[model samples]
Target chain A: MTESPQGQAPSGAAADVPVAFQDPSYLAAVVDLLGAIAYGEMSAFERLAEDAKMSPTLADKAELARMASTEFGHFEGLRQRLADLGADPFEAMAPFEKPFDAFHARTAPSDWLEGLVKAYVGDGLAADFYREIAAFLDAGTRDLIIESLADAGQSQFVVDRVRGAIEDDHRVGGRLALWGRRLMGEALSQAQRVAAERDALSALLSGGVDRPGMDLAAIGRLFTRLTENHSARMEKLGLAA
Target chain B: MTESPQGQAPSGAAADVPVAFQDPSYLAAVVDLLGAIAYGEMSAFERLAEDAKMSPTLADKAELARMASTEFGHFEGLRQRLADLGADPFEAMAPFEKPFDAFHARTAPSDWLEGLVKAYVGDGLAADFYREIAAFLDAGTRDLIIESLADAGQSQFVVDRVRGAIEDDHRVGGRLALWGRRLMGEALSQAQRVAAERDALSALLSGGVDRPGMDLAAIGRLFTRLTENHSARMEKLGLAA
Candidate 1:
């Protein structure tokens, strides 16, 4: 859960992709990771737009639209990175479509409050997991991941709106609390399935000959950290994890 | 319609909010105009996002997402300008919402191709109308309208896709040509409703004593230009006017 002890001092944006990408598996894994993140961003954008449509007020709609635009901005970067890596961004995203779609289908929020909770909890969990993976990548890729995962100032808005709704009706809080839990569960199920299927990506965690990677214990700790963060986010929304 | 014959030389970004705004009605009209455009941008963003969800391919979805994001970007600029003009952006948008919403509700696309044609013809018509109004405004607000209405480059993609679909099935062209006409009809109806309801906005055309405004003849010419432009856009999309 801690920063990779083997982490080198920041390289500060290397001129080219680091030499580590010369390894075919490392290259494949990085491509897979970026593709997954990019697709998730696109999905996030679409979901936020849907939420905007369902928003009760113009201000709320504008807020969601801004967040959606921010997600698309990040997606554009990841997409360009995929192309620079000589992978067709769409092709790279292809393998991820089913799992992400399935996850969204299974966890589609029923209303505005549910959508806000999912956006908060689901995005936090994904960001945490990706940040953990970023620890093991080369400097350039790591920097890109950090930038791509930057929050678009939606957390406080979600927290304010959700907590306000709960204040108006306590029953709303209980239902949303349950919704948060379901989001967490569905997200984990899909993520685990992706990890199981993507060997190159999973291998990025298990150390190679020269690169440092997480051990089993470290992987366990990483999940623990992710869970803790998810719980913290839920609590922030005044919902139980 | 031809350019304003009495047009002043471009003042090139006036400071002190232009003397013309000293007129209370002019200020209200400018605010009304900006509010209408801003609300339209937000509406366009939501609609494109909807179309994106209905798109058949990831590439198509990404394209629509990009357009949605672009609309939101313009919305942000207009929102800030409204605030700068001492109008609560949301309050300013309120008066225009019903008409814009009604426009969207009446013309909602039944499928992806219908969505594309609407985007193409609908946006082109709206942009043309706003640009015409821009001609009668102070330089600063005029520049903002011009910038906000700039096309997000969806024209070629929409034209290509819609035309390709038509090429695949001759029936599609006929259906979409009719769709284009409906979009034009619905848009003009909504716009006219808004103009009638918002007196100051309409007054912008019938001049103040010192400032030039369009005569009935000029108003006739303006509609002619808008219709001609709409037909031209449809023709470009391989659809009949």
Candidate 2:
């Protein structure tokens, strides 16, 4: 339920503090997480931009595609932060190749609405998790994280469209609600897979001096918060909870 | 060769004016071009960002990946401009999908150097063309085109790396140069396909107004300029003429 303290140095005099970057295990975990998120941002932007072409009108199309642009900004910030911490962004992202790839493959959207739903649900959880951990980071890194999670511009548009569709044709909301649920399920499944397989990252999450006291229970609680937000978002859009 | 007029208006006294939004036919052609370019930008960013991981150090990785970020910004500008012109970005892009897709498919990079070489040659020509077209466009649309072409940040980085690699290993340049040549050839072939198929776009290139004293030879010269730029760029990077 608590934020990961991986971003902090061990408590001591400044000179005597054990820098997390100096610890190979810690660096590896952080790098892995950063890479996963960075690539996620990259792929997310590409797909969203591509799907924007599917919009029925120019205004909606531009609005939808512009949302993807924000992802690139986020990707750049994460990439630079990773580099600042002595990690290669691409290499750091490589270990995430399989799980994230699988997650996207399994949840490939079949329509524009599905794509929007994925962006809404997937990016929402990511921003939430990043926002929490960002609280524990240095001012610069935390600032970057917060800035990256700022409004995606299309959120209101997405809500309006979804709500309008629900109002005009009640049957559509049920399908999209199911789609939203599946997206979350795949995301959580991938999160667990990554945590279980990457021990350095697992240790950073569960065993670090800075991250002490965090456990699977915390992750579960995080997911609970994410689902609560997702439900609220759906209700706001006139979709079934 | 000659600069393509921005976009033709639908009808009325303002018919000759170069508006950002054109008739559906002209809008379709512009979107076709922009879509192909946008998709190219998206894919290039993904590939180059991934390639940056192959770098030996964090600084190098960040530097390389940062180049990819520039393309995202260009993509955003083009998408927005498409919207301003009342063109559904995706629909405008859909018609040219096959050729563009085929070009990238046949020329997928086999390594980091290969990837860089493609960007260096491929984007160099694209920038050149966009620069020429900017002259014929209305101020607002022209400004967007010029801004988009101002810097191929990532492409230049790739060129720098490619040049360095050639310097380090003389033998590598020859092979990369060949790859560069092939990429340009494919690109030109695709360009011809687009020109031949999209009449409004071709008409735009031929000079839309049919002015009494219009110089068609000037258009031929424009193509010459693009070719010359491409050759100079390739030679600078140690690619064959």
Candidate 3:
């Protein structure tokens, strides 16, 4: 059977919600956006846990576990928000699952350092994109999105580990650069897939009845900023962007 | 090289702590006990995250992830305590790796239900044993241990899942009963191994110069209580003890 279109509201206690969300499409779009972030957090948690498996030291493992726990923490916040918005959080998260799962499966890190780079670069990009989207959202949701995007100082941890590994062996730098680029590419591809499939999300991005949003040119600038930040992150790790 | 005995205080800031913890041996033992629980929490995090993979639905997966996050939360608290006591948390947890990993391996669940049962039953048993050991500890350490063992209401989730499964198919209850028994047995074996290997921990339990501890009868009763609790838990899942 063909999959249901994204942002089609799942039946639940959505009727009594606020005026802002009363428009069914706005509610669906918000649910879709929140769902995507929720799935992203869960996937991040799973990937981070998997990454810990390859940690060379117990300290490193603990670091990865800490990141995993923090991602799960954000996940709870998003899931609750989805419920408060009157969507069943799980059903809300369902549409984006295939894309996120596929991204992780394709980019499964072969070793510890690569896993660290992916954790940092990939999540950094996702956070950037979400922050941009938050600009077009309501104050409450935008704040929640921004709050959930807090990296908890994890980027520095990844930078230190990755840079330390590169210093230990200069040759490691070249391989990880490729790994970082691939992470960006795969992440973008999956994200594009999500954008194409999720009409409500696209509508939210383009502009809604009352909410202001990014124009095509504005979005292009946003992409430029995202790419620039990704490069800057790679540079921080002593790698070529 | 022979593995260092569990609870051997590594040399460091342990030099000038509290008067009680200043007894290097007592310090090592407490660090060791905290380390054991810390490693147990990490292992539990890993195991719960693994169990989440088999979740039949996104909601179930989130429930497992929430539990995993809570375990890591406890782990962070214990690790901080270890550092406060002047031990590198990793080195402290190192001695426990083999036993906890082995216990998890032996009791690895064959399916989702088995994993849930292991999570609820195995962790319940470990918490009971730790609480028993906590009775012999200093107030600070004892309080930390008790705090770390908080179940976060996970029992009801597991019980609901397991009981619902049993109701769906009676045969499931019989198999889960055996799984629960295996989890209990493996847990006891690992706990015995830890006791035999950690001299300071054993000394702590048996009573040191100033510390009052479990007499042989008290130890026997502790075992009786742990077993009774396990039986009660199994009964709650609609399985035989």
Q: Top model by DockQ, which number?
A: 1
RMSD of each: 7.1, 8.9, 8.5
Model 1 residue A232 CA deviation in Å: 1.7
| DockQ of each two-chain model | 0.78, 0.12, 0.66
Q: A145-187 in candidate 2: lDDT tens per residue?
A: 6777776733888888887877888888999989878887888
If the candidates were sorted by their TM-score against the true structure, best first, what order would they fall in? Answer: 1, 3, 2
lDDT over C-alpha atoms for residue B90 of model 2 = 66
- The lDDT, on a scale of 0 to 1, for candidate 2 is 0.69
lDDT minimum window of 10 residues, candidate 1 chain B: B7-16
iRMS, candidate 3, in Å: value is 0.7
TM-score of predicted model 1? 0.92
The lDDT leader among the candidates is 1
- The residue pairs that clash in candidate 3, if any, are none
Candidate 1 segments whose C-alpha is farther than 4 A from its true place? A1-14, B1-14
Off by over 4 Å in 3: A1-19, A209-211, B1-17
Per-residue alpha-carbon lDDT of candidate 1 for residues A1-241, written as tens digits (9 for 90 to 100)? 6664467543455444646668999999999999999999999998888877789999999999998899999999999888878889998998899999898899888999998888888888888999999999887888898898888634699999999999999999889988888888899999999989999999999978988988999989998999899888888899888
In candidate 1, what are the lDDT values of residues B82-146, reduced to their tens digit? 88788899999999999998988998899999999888888888899999998989888998899
lDDT by residue for model 2 (B1-241), tens: 4544666445442343355444555455556666666666655555556555455654455554556667766777777666666667666666666777678787887877787677677777877876676565546655666677655543555667778898899999889878877887888898888878877666656655431222579878887898788779888787786
RMSD of 1: 7.1
